[model samples]
Target chain A: MIQAEHLTKRYGFTTAIQDVSFEVRKGEILGFLGPNGAGKTTTMRILAGFFPATEGRAIVAGFDVFEKPLEVKKRVGYMPEHPPLYEEMSVDAYLRFVATIKGVDRDKIDSRLGDVKARCGLAEEGSRLIKHLSKGYKQRVGLAQALIHEPEVLILDEPTIGLDPKQIIEVRELIRGLAGDHTVILSTHILPEVSMTCERVIIINNGKIVVMDTPENLTSQLSGGERIELDIVGPVENLPALLREIPQVKNVSLGEPQNARQPVLVETEGSADVRHLIARKVIESGLDLYRLSTQTMTLEEIFVKLTTEEETQEEETE
Target chain B: MRNYLAIVTKELRTLFVSPIAYVVLAVFFAITGYFFYIILGNVIEFVMQRAFQSQQFGAAPPPFDAPAAVIRGFFGILSTILLFLIPMITMGIFAEEKKRGTIELLFTSPLTHLQLILGKFTALILFLLVMLVPTIVNSILLYLLSEPAPRLVTMLVGYLGAFLLGGALLAVGVFISSLTENQIVAAVLTFGTFLILWVIDATAGTGSTITNETIRYLSILNHYEDFTKGVLDSQHVIFYLSFIFLGLFLTSVSLDSGKWRG
Candidate 1:
């Protein structure tokens, strides 16, 4: 439902996002993963029509964000990093106001208000003053406002940033529930949120999309191949050659020796199963093998590696 | 149209529910009420002294014309009071939204920039009218107690002048508020700009003939005085209308520039 092409945004001499392109299909939740100052918010803001892109084009729900912003805005609901709340207003009042401005029809407003309030777990707190509520409740109100109009596309920036763990889970569940009906583009630095809640992930770093794929694919595909961690009680000086002698074992490196147990990290080619061979090799060599386990790359590891590597590459280029 | 009304309704709701707005309104009423009582009392004392002197000389007293002397004078003071009070009412209209990041909500909505600006401007005007309730009540009291009541047409015209002048200043305040996220900065800038407008006539009086004429023409006070005199000249109406349009236009341009910048 959303397509951004060569989306570049610059603030005077500083480029916030440059040539960042991505797409979100209908009824899909796309997670934008990046560290702080990674131009995630800038990209979302451009799509929301809060500001125009310095260059490039964005189309949302078949409307050009720049040329037909009002049409695009009608179809998209955006919640910024900070909940745009009027603290003095009651929850019901704030939602009602948002519903009205979002063009919720006069007759449908009541039902929509009830629906969003219920969906966001805000039914009981409808009459409470927003300033009196905790931060989690305030976030629910923000989500409620975004959903009040039953928008076709929702762009939420760090929807769970300040919430407690329970509230975060609740918000994630709420977002996951919205997948089949709404096209969602959620941005955050949090990794598990992407894995748990999003179907597709777009990892943006330094104003560019460094990687885009399913969370599982991002981890497996980006990290090269299989890895195995071996903790052995033996003299580790000649272990690299012995481990490399196995056919599929691509490389081997020893970690620190502590209390006579040495840690060995073994790399293998794509999806290879070399555990049995390594076990037999340790036995034949008379080395005591204390611990050996296949280690798959986590999303966090891939994320840190990709983002940090991107920074290093940029530094080298500079 | 519905979007505009929605925005206006929301703005009014925010303004009325805030304790600070009421505090400012109460303080305004107290100050204006005191001035009203003092002005009425002085006009009454002057009328009585004239009656006494004329009776001793076996002649009629000069026509008091309370509408001209008192009601018009009251409106004149009302305009000046609104000079300070309008900024208080408008300082937070855009600045607060900017500070709280609610401008994102408005900008991303389906509403047009013109609709948003007009919606907010209309809300502030309505709030200014609400603020004038006590003054209206004071006028009603003068209407009831005076022997020869204030002229209905004069009272209406003078109140119109006050409203138009207040509307123009509020528009200027809205534009100033849009310039910054700091309400205090917005208020101070609005006040400074208004002070210059108020004193422009004084500056005009000392300048050369052509300069004086041009400055007086540009001065808001010059156009407003005619309305206070019960003269319904279309020129003053046009001036206030154009001033309001200019302010709103500038505000819209300022807002639309957000798309061009960050």
Candidate 2:
């Protein structure tokens, strides 16, 4: 378990992260979603005891990161954004070195080595020098090093970055499989990685936590006032008039579709979906309804809306 | 303790697998071989009465040839050269990790700063011993062909002296390596620092006798000279211990401070 209270990390005059607080429970997978330069990595570093919080405190696995770092370090396994790896070492040697440094039992090193190497997909390349391994393999080796001691808390920053789609999926699956035993906190800019691999998300922007909730709740929060898009093969000018007559419709807008196949861009008001109304109208008018898709406000839309509003507030203050 | 050994093993593994060991050994052997050949050839000719021109020899017709003294002389000078070479060896200690960003992995581990520092120093000392082996072999070769074998204790003292001096320099080098991520800068600063320590004695050479002696004692070279002569003064032991302690202390502080500065 990890809990932080008003964690602030300032670099001279600039505050990289300020007043950030969050808690991750046992066996919970939390995603730190932030844009670049949003202090995501800085917060992770503090949690991992790699950097001291400037004004606040973090307790990781029941040990204060600043005051009792050795115990916290013992309980946590951190894979930094860059995946700290030594190029000259082989995969096996590096993992073994990490295992020993983490104080893994001497007798269990062999079994730990076997278990970790297999789990991290590094078994086949145990003998390969790290420098010679591809980026994906190097990442796997990094994950192996983190898991070598069977640590209870795993903090991985952007674990799936810079990997091919297949490699990304593989890493994601690996991270997903780690949720039951290890309290995992992973940071990334990719939204769906959180949706797919994490149960809860702490969306951080401008060094502050904007929202923290389950994936379902976050999506559902933005679910009201649903938007719909339609492609009707009829008089473009008549589409807006017909849509306005619907009882649930409050407003409609017709514009050039981004794609030639889309034909018409439709904006609807109110939470009620009018896809059925437009469908009936289209057939009655003897016009072809080529495509109809219902759109809900997605996580991407919510993210943009909240973060842009934050920027606008800042601009107004300035 | 296990963590310390783990780090040491890791260092040894790197020393074996990387090109640094080969390159360092090649350059070390090449330089030491040249000096050895000159030292031996001069001694051989001097013994044969072809060229007995050096002032280091005494006029007594002593029973034992001064083979041991000659070996000591060689190691004393070799250690002086090591003041330069060991810095190069330690340049990669912390600097390379900082550069490659692998230091995060080590720093975030459960090990204490003391374990990390001691582990690194142990590896460097072991490597220094490995460097000494070939030179020791060079001495053995000299003994087989020479008329009077070297006084074993005297040669042993010189090698031990060299080891102590090497340890001190290595400590300084590790600290310097931690101050920066650039290896070249670390190597240069490390060498420059020892160079200053190497000459600290001579600055008081013209002053009062007591001042001169104290400064000489302050110089690492002077403390090493006592050991080179085969006397393990408690003073010299303290001096080397202080060197190890100071170096490790400063490195630990430097690393600890990084946690504070954003």
Best by TM-score: 1
Candidate 2's error at B245, in angstroms?
A: 1.5
Question: How much RMSD separates candidate 1 from the native structure?
Answer: 10.5
Every prediction: chain A TM-score: 0.73, 0.73
Model 1 chain B scores worst on lDDT over the 10 consecutive residues at B63-72
Report, to 2 decimal places, the DockQ of model 1.
0.57
Which parts of model 2 have CA positions greater than 4 angstroms off?
A220-302, A305-318, B46-69, B144-148, B209-215
lDDT of 2 by residue, A178-207 (tens): 998999999988766789999999988778
Which candidate tops lDDT? 1
Chain B TM (all candidates)? 0.94, 0.88
- Candidate 1 residue-wise lDDT at A86: 93
Q: Model 2 compared with the native: what TM-score?
A: 0.79
Clashing pairs in 1: none
lDDT of 1 by residue, A69-181 (tens): 98888899999999999999999889888888888888998899889988999989999999999999999998998888888999999998878778888999999999989
Query: How many pairs of residues collide in model 1?
Result: 0
